[model samples]
Target chain A: MWKSVIYKEWLKTRWFLIIYAAIGVLAVGRIFLKVQHDFTFNEATNFWYVILFQGYQYFGILKFLPALGGLIIAVSQFFPETVNKRIKLTFHLPIVENKVMIIMMLFGACCLLLTFGVVSLFFYGLSIIYFPHEIIHGALVTMTPWFLAGLAIYFLAALIILEPVWKFRFLYALVAVAFIPSVFFDDTITGGYSPANPVLFVLVIIMSTALLFSGYRFRKGEM
Target chain B: MVRLSRYFLVIIAIIAFSVVIPKFYWMAFEKPVRSPFVMYSCVENDFMIQKSTQDGLVRTDTRGNNYTREQYEEKLPLMYMRQLMISGTMPDTINGVFMDAREINDERSTFRLRTRDLFTPDPGLYPMFESQSGRANLEMPDDYFRITWRMEFVDANTNKILEEKSRMFSAVLYNRGFDFPAKSINGIPTTRKSIDEGYLVIDSEDQLFHVKMIKGKPFVEKVEIPEGLKFKHISCVDFRNKRYYAYLFSEENDLYILTQDDYVLKKLPVDGLIPEEQEIKIYADYFHYNIISDGEGYMRSQILDADFNPVDEYSETWPVKMERTEGKIYKFLFPGELSLSNSNSNYNAFFLNLNKSINWLVLSLILIVIQFFIIKRRNEKFKNQIVDFTAILFTGIFGFLAVNIFPNKFFK
Candidate 1:
């Protein structure tokens, strides 16, 4: 029964994964184009710095992409199918309601992970090509916190929309504001911006945990 | 709820560890030094100019030809050292004399000459001359020449002088071939212009003299009366020595003497007496010889003799008190008339303390609120998603930080 639910969730959002993949490929291609310029070793390093440091701001337009994708996938395929009346059918089919929801969530997480992985890979490749003289072996390693933060934001948004409580929407908006302040950490705050630092790492974890807890409360409270 | 609490504790622990550990490391190993001094040099030659020094060193490509450090230093004067101390450049060297000659006749012509001098020293440094020259002569129509006269000095690093000398040459011509009588005015042709105008007329045989143009008008005789009031000398307060001096000019036109403050026991004159026919003249043995008000609320004339002195003197109503309080220095109440507007903004200890406390409090509250939420949903799918997202984000942020914070550590 869990397998069936996961399969249904995957089938529903397959088109989104395809689109994300295409966009990721194109974005990565643009980064490669920049690498083709004739540059001194220092200039190349500076170019990579600009790409890495400013890439998030450029990608800010895509902030809504994951949340929107998650929302559509969750509302159309998961929530509607798991509505109070329809839930009985799913729960009674040799599987517990909790197991079905968990499987569906896993399926959605897999799709998100795939999308983020592709985007991160593209960034990694660009960094390598542009800063050939500089070592970028740790580029992906440093990106871990940002990737996690992005996923946390997406999950938090989905949870707020799905929650039974009316105030959850407001809470979600507050979290969004809080997220904005965190984004500015890279620019204004000295150590707050870096992902690799233990302090920022902890912050990412705490924010992620809060997002997850909020989602958990919504899921446990009602439909 | 218990599961949620566990999650919250875990997150708090992680954040605390991340923030605290690196800060400890930074404090122990990465504190930067206070001073990072470099040197620079400035030199000019026909082909190229380069300046380099031990502190604030700057090197530029001279297009293949390299200058040795020793050769560059030789051309520069010791007066430039003060300019270097203040991080200023030496001024350009453009010194020459101007000579004008008029023809009294083709072969025997009278002559008059006037010499003009122009030279600028390194801005902040005291200038010392090693050698200088100026001369004037004429070579027929359309040909004019001036030669540098011999002058040399080893400028005292401490004492600076603005010594300038000008000479006017005059002579009369007689046409011996035509039996023309020697041109004489009263006694001598050379004395004719001086006796008539009460001042010398500058000219040579080839150059003709005409009515002098004073501000575009024909020059007229203007009698000037010397005021009975005379100044002994004027000097600014030397903060380094905590003393003042008066520079006095003698009536006999002897050497000027710098007298100590004790020598001027009488109340010094506040206003300067100017010659009726001439503009107000303030004579001080300093670079900036401008009259200004001094302390005691009088519109007294003053001069900043040295580069280190304040660019301008305080106005009549400037405050004369300063004190230290709570480990910080403060200037006392200034007079309303004094211009203290250019002073730097005062430091506010209260604001600094308030900002620091607010930053810490906000950060702590954010941490606490996040922990509370994490603890409230440990077992939910949404909680897992949040954790997954956070893990990825934290990983990314950490990667970014590592790349930046430890560039040398990672690159190597």
Candidate 2:
């Protein structure tokens, strides 16, 4: 039963995941390519000086891509469930309805992890090539929030799309816009978000549960 | 499971609205504060004020006596020396001291300090320039240094450690009574300064040292801080006068200057100056050390004689945001404010600036009643929405928005 559910979700989401991974690779490649070009144009010392003293982030281009990836994955996976009440057919599968919903979301979560993990590995390799441990550590501390923001937005997009009523869905989307962008604050070259990142992480973890209510409401055919 | 999801949604919605609405209210209503520009007059021995008015800018002393432009400049000759020199109306001598623009420029300097200067985190590497390099302009060095377990320098060209130079510097540091690791370091790395004073570094155990590189040699001098004093921040100053190396902000909020007179830490007798949340301006002239602490709605100024004894101290207050009508309305409309960052730090986090006054609770009560009547009109049973009522009571306006957005149809 588990293998069947997993294979079913893969059939639904395989193409979108491929596109997601491609976009991740492209963003990482473009940013590091520009960084390499800039490193060659200026002396290595001068390049380090601007990043260290002037508060410039070389990986700033990767900031919004994670959030966008979350949104796209949610739309691809769940937007189909809302059409023609196709979720009713999904619930009819020979498993506990909520268990099936959890499986689907878990599948989407793994997809998100794989996509972002590839970008993170690329960042690690290129970061060590042109900079010292200090700049590399700064890049890690700075990207922590951006990656978390992407994860949070994914959970939020799931909750918004699973909701049965249009009014509530719009409201959830509105709230997401109002607060989620805050995680990606000013991209300082070094650490500024250390104290705040844990709170945001816990919030997103709690957010992953809110979509269950939307699933339950759809089962009851609430409008 | 359903009940838990509803509660979670309610809480999250309250937080989101709290973050957005109060900030939006202020975005529409906040007014810029107009503070008076003040400088101390050497001739009158009083603080001068240049404030905007309907007529024009009014120039007056703290004593309320007004002066014309020429008279105001004459009263503050050292401050307005260039203007006096440009007009050829400058004094050849004043108070038995010879006066000239060049003399004034060489003898005076300004240093402004903010909280972010010391508190903001940075990449832990610095380029040390040669102080006495015999070059007309300071040049950037090839390596960046980090003082961790021991001093280590990474060659910028290769991004690798120069093991030999690192060993040489660490040896000098160990011999100077320096502890193995440093706690805090502050120095300006740019070449724009008139001179290089290197860095003021506090060792792991609060021992202070002035570290500099001169002609390819290490010049590390341990500064003797007064007993039981610990520094929270050090603002390194490279004044052309060479009077002081830095202004030290102590953990107890005491301000001190590290004087060039054999590295003596001279304490300034002042209080209520928090280096983090206020803008501090220090203007030193031929005779007085004028320190101004500008805070949210008030500003305090003190003048000390050349030897650092208190000469005069004065404080003034102005109406701030909370004192205005728009801010009062904001209190009645929003229960709390949600902010990502503040003036003190740049990091983004959820900052709940709660309105702890009676006004906030009153507004919450009002919003509860409004939500209650709306639910009653919608034919939703009262007992079924106890959770919603509770959310409205605590979250006020945010709670009202959430309940309406999710409408308790199950209760109906």
Misplaced by over 4 Å in model 2 are: A186-189, B53-56, B68-70, B408-412
lDDT of 1 at B292: 33
* Alpha carbon lDDT at B151, candidate 1: 14
Candidate 1 — what's its lDDT? Answer: 0.32
- Relative to the unseen true structure, what is the C-alpha lDDT of residue A215 in candidate 2, on a scale of 0 to 100? 85
Model 2, span A121-216: residue lDDT tens: 988887787889888887788888888888788888988898888887888889888767644554343677777778877877777776677888
For model 1, report DockQ. 0.01
- The lowest-lDDT stretch of 10 consecutive residues in candidate 2 chain B is B403-412
lDDT of 1 by residue, A46-125 (tens): 33334333332322333344444444544544455435645446556676545554565566666777877777777775
Off by over 4 Å in 1: A37-99, A133-145, A180-192, A195-223, B1-412
lDDT of 1 by residue, B1-412 (tens): 3244225523433333333333343345442222111111212322123333355433332343454444443333232333433554323321221111111011111111111000111011111111111212211111111111211111121111213211111111111111111111110112112111111111212111111112212232211213342322222222222222222222221112222323222232333422211122233321333333222212333333333242333222322222113111111110011110111211101011011112233333444344435434443334434443343233222222222121111111
Q: Name the TM-score of chain A in model 1.
A: 0.65
DockQ scores for all predicted structures = 0.01, 0.61
